[model samples]
Target: MKTLLSLSIGALLAGSSLLSTSALAATHAPYTHTQFSITESVQPADILVVLVPENAGELRLAGWDRASRNHINRAIEVAGFDGKAGAQLEIVAPVGLSYGRLLLLGTGNPADLTRAKAETMGASLSTWVNGTKAESIHVNSQLIANAADNHRISAALAHGVELRNYRFDRYKSQPEARPSQRYSWQVALATDARSKFEQKQALAQGVFTARELTNLPGSDGYPEAFANYAKTVLEPLGVEVTILGPEEVKALGMGALYGVSQGSHMKAHLLVARWRGHDDAQPIALVGKGNSFDTGGYNLKTQAASILRMHTDKAGGAAVVGAVKALAGQKAPVHVVGVVPLSINMISGDAYLPGDVVTAGDGTTIEVGNTDAEGRLILADGIWYAREHLNARVIADIATLTGAKVGALGSAYSAIFTQDAAIEQSLRQAGELVQERVWPMPLDGYDGIVRSRIADKINTGSPGAQAGAIFLQHFAADTPWVHIDMAGEAFVSSASGIHPEGSTGHGVRLLTEWAKLYQAKQD
Candidate 1:
């Protein structure tokens, strides 16, 4: 970790020269004096200055005071361009002196101060300073206050920017450098003196940890390696970790998981992580499908679809582990048992055929209608084991389980299916708060699609490709469970806001926030 940190520092300093005071002042100073024809009194020293269009002149007056025409001063300098839209200025006077730089960011219209807009502006600012060497940043809360709840909005904006600014250049030979030296950052709040920034910080740490896990390649993040990583990350937080190897899984009668692992040379394992934050409480169980690589078994996927990006099928398990890490890191007052059913689904002579019949840990036999429908197969035993053996009160399983969900929801939101509406609503609300959307779909009538003619259930849908989410819900068996199919949103092909292209690290923030809320309600 120290070496990585050192490399990061070295990368930042390599391309740029030692920053000079005058040059630094020119680049880092906040106030830009560019001319603008406005009726309001604008001062460079003010943390937040109001900008109202000439049209809506009949607003409020207390937080708004305009100087006469004769009271106007020189030209207004803008932050970015010298002659573009308007002026960019930095407030470098009394209030901004300690902060070193104060930037007057431009909004084309004064009415654009809505919360979403403010967050966008914050994100833009963070992007502009990506490689720069600025330590702590303070933005005037007034600009975003009218747009959003000041503290919450600002914290989220700060979080988005900080997370976006993270770069994984550990292996780069000669990395480019940026100015700004504070490794740690502080976002000055414009509102609410009692905001929960500490909690938010912990949540941010958890998200970062998840990002790290998801970013690792399949070779480094296989079942055994992933389990070891989880142990190393969570055990120090006082979370009890248990890794069940192939022998233990077989002995425990996790036939569904074992059947899925029959094709791969690598052994299947189940990781049970328990964080007893409070004593004598029924744990909330999180089950994740850990298919490290999926080759579709006997029902093989195309070479284009199965070769390079197959590793990301384990992202669901990554999220579960990530959420646990976050929960333990924050020391939340709720017990959580995370069950990750880990394996590689490959095709071989010894691989289970499409017509094979396998029994789950609960003694329910399932006919393998399609070997490609393997995620649900593994998760079946995992969810059952978590509920029956661990005695879970609430169970939620996440997986890149189906392509149909991607077709239904696109890349914008993950599809959620649950028997309990309350849990579904909570998860949806949490996802909204974090800007990771989740849409709930029906799970009640979907059992009919998975009903088997010969066995208790079937692993897949009928001949056609309809209702993939519904078919996967059969594995949850009657438990109060929520199934999150993050197939589309788990990994991206390009960068968007805080999410990079490789691994979106989708559910970490949402699950962590939901856990916090659940714990609060329990308390």
Candidate 2:
């Protein structure tokens, strides 16, 4: 009932090739370009992108000559473009340009350049440039001096542009009435680090896959459906895929996950996808909480507003499926085992009550303080699956776990819970590089919070995030693990930057980069 969306893998060049006078190519463009069009390959560019950094007084047009620089500056002043970050000025028929139009892109400061900004700039470029009919546009990243920085910045920019060019109009009844994907055009971007483009493209594909899966309605993307998607896509890309049915999960003592699904019509599942890039090393474990739909079971979110957006509750599982797709497709030199426990927390005649006690995969009893707090129960089983079945050495689990986390961080960061130094540091570095930021919170001091009179632990407490993480820690035992609460960051209410108006695909980039970091350190 679901279809895999087409992904574009643009042409990659080794270095900058000479452009004719009509092409408006930069002399110092160090990167060889990849020719990619957002739509089909038949279109041509409508504009050209040139970046200018802001200095003390005037804009620093490093690559442009004096005459063209003055003309661009005059146009900026006339258009009130202050070279501010995300500011733009359009010029028609400038003094020295190959294309008829010019886009004055801004970088606040040269020294403060980051991958996040690069991605934003790239998205800004697509949002503005793709608004026009120009099919092919070029990016000039010549001003950046460091070859590696140039490569990262330029590739991130292109990746951003590619990300923003997405649309999920599958369920629209009047699909034709819905806006066609117009923010898609051919893009010619240059970067000296050619491999970075391949990697970034792979990462973008992962993000896109996650977004698409999350965007699907609950009726189309139940637990079994998601498992099928993994095998359909990842298996073809050389990833080993496994789907554990409710009986299989129950037989393995995944009581916590099974309890959450007993109320729903669809049976629960534990899906695993493995990429064995390095046979000699143990694969890093990635776990996701895949609650296809959270009706809150007995403690239901009866409010219309809360129930409407419950379809996105499975973002964490969608991300695991996506990351493996990218890594396997790219043939990344890393080993990864992605685990996702899929279930729908719905209300029914047999729905588990709020006060019900259940034993988990690790044989620990849990008092279900609130059925709405069900993400952690599934993740508990997932963590146990990673350790007992996969023999995980390092694990990271992502979920839309706690409303408290969103209240604390808004939509900016995922609340990270871990006590491991190396894993925490690597996650932080990866978050910064890819901009899916993780803010570490405490793992201890939760013993008294989730304490129950009868059961070993209760599911909810005053501080929901800490208690949820602590509950999961019981299953992880002594393994190095990190719990990421992505309640706010995984889905959005409006279009912004690289994210469209819906599913944000928040954890894909961070996990992909972290896998790369782990692979690098181990090798």
Candidate 3:
């Protein structure tokens, strides 16, 4: 039997308050990313953000009046700020504008603009505003709104600001001062799109939630603690959260997953959060690898540089937890199930070692080729549990599984593996929409790599790095599954547009968008 993890509800609740869980509130708070406002005219603000496109030596402000356009043109000429994609120039208290400063932002060419660029620009704006004393921003999206249809530019821009503005200040005695909360955003020509803005804002809430959970110290939660945090945030959204302790997992014959947590005193768990908005539809399962902290077991990561940051090993589970919360919050008409297998790989007398054999819940025995390759071991059980117990028709698993993945893809894109063409296309669309890029990779002659001498299969291939997606397929049986190896994408050491410097909260938006598209097609 697997060692079971238990939740301390009272303690978890205490931590929940610290999480600042909801982004639904209109008024900004430390946890709340930012607030949205729609306006027909530019409001008097500390900063006026204008989106301008490149035009050689000539500056064209076609969207504004003659005087306003001429003033901006002359300023652009004098400042020498070409409307390049990321170019920015601040005009402090320009004569024609009511605001104290006119922030001229570049957008390449107006016709060539897209949602991704707009969002990145928005994030860039937020980062700049944070560094300045400016507390309010009035965005003039007049020129770029038509660049991307479906209000995509404005909606995505707001989404990016909401994302970039997330701050985890609960633990800070003197939290760094941020202008996001005290800040006000006025988007010109968006009065009619209040509902759309709110919807995008709601999605941002999910991304922020995932970031919070991932940013939390690994010491804050092992398997049990992670589940407790999920329940605390998800229960109020009316999402049905079921916690399966190690015993329950063992009962289902998830020996492969169970064996990983054998050495740790903190019990491992599988947390399932469900949102059954449509009764007739077959549920789509989102499985995550929630390795609370990995110590590499017997195959110690003694030479690892960032071993201390292993706390973020649960980015996948956090994404799953955040996805259901946002879906339920948005009231999307899709039946969804999220399965997060939570555990911590520790060093102890009882720790599972390399060469040990573990029988998975699906009855496939996995030879422990490397104890450090613990993610797929846990995912083996999560993937099976989602398929069988949850009756999930489609399964998508996300994990920070392999170091080789980081070496291969870097932070540019998460590696996606699947033989199914449709799954790849769906995820690709979702990733593009959110700026979280996914690269499709072939599962070449990899089956032979994991062939074992003793067990039915080994946990990993010979080189042992790029085998995550391939090894996971063995436990998936006949189920059509998509594995996202986000080793490089999940945690970022440097800040980028709309994304802070840590725990990227990578899969929440992609997973959410995929479910939305699936539901739309079904309808």
- How many pairs of residues collide in model 3? 1
Error (Å) of candidate 1 at residue 463 is 9.4
lDDT of 3 at 108: 76
What C-alpha lDDT do the candidate models reach, one value each? Answer: 0.63, 0.75, 0.76
Using lDDT as the yardstick, the better of models 1 and 2 is 2
Per-residue CA lDDT of model 1 for 227-269, tens digit only, reads 7767766777788999999889989888889988887667789
Candidate 3, residue 121: how far the Cα is off, in Å: 0.2
lDDT of 2 at 453: 84
Candidate 3 per-residue C-alpha lDDT over 1-523 given as tens digits, one digit per residue, 9 for 90 to 100 = 1121211111111224344322211212335535556665545567777766676455444345667767776888888888887799887777665677788778777666677787887788777777777766666666554523325556666777767877666667887765443333334334445556666765776777788778877667578877877887777778999999888877888888889999987768989999988884569899999998888889888866667778888999889887887788778888999999998898899988899999998888889998999999999889988887877778899988888887888878889998888888888988987778899987876558888899988887754445777788766777788899888677777788778878788889889989887667656
Report RMSD (Å) for each prediction in the order shown. Answer: 10.2, 9.5, 7.6
For 54-139, candidate 2 gives per-residue lDDT tens digits of: 64255444445788878877877778776566667889877775667888777656557778887888888877765665656655
Report the CA-based lDDT of candidate 1 relative to the real structure.
0.63
Off by over 4 Å in 3: 1-30, 53-70, 80-86, 108-111, 143-150, 181-191, 463-466, 521-523
* Cα error of candidate 2 at position 474, Å: 0.2
lDDT of 1 at 292: 80
Each candidate structure's TM-score, on Cα atoms with residue i matched to residue i, is 0.75, 0.85, 0.87
Off by over 4 Å in 1: 1-102, 105-122, 131-154, 170-195, 303-306, 462-475
| Decoy 3 TM-score against native | 0.87
Specify the poorest-scoring 10-residue window by lDDT in model 3: 4-13
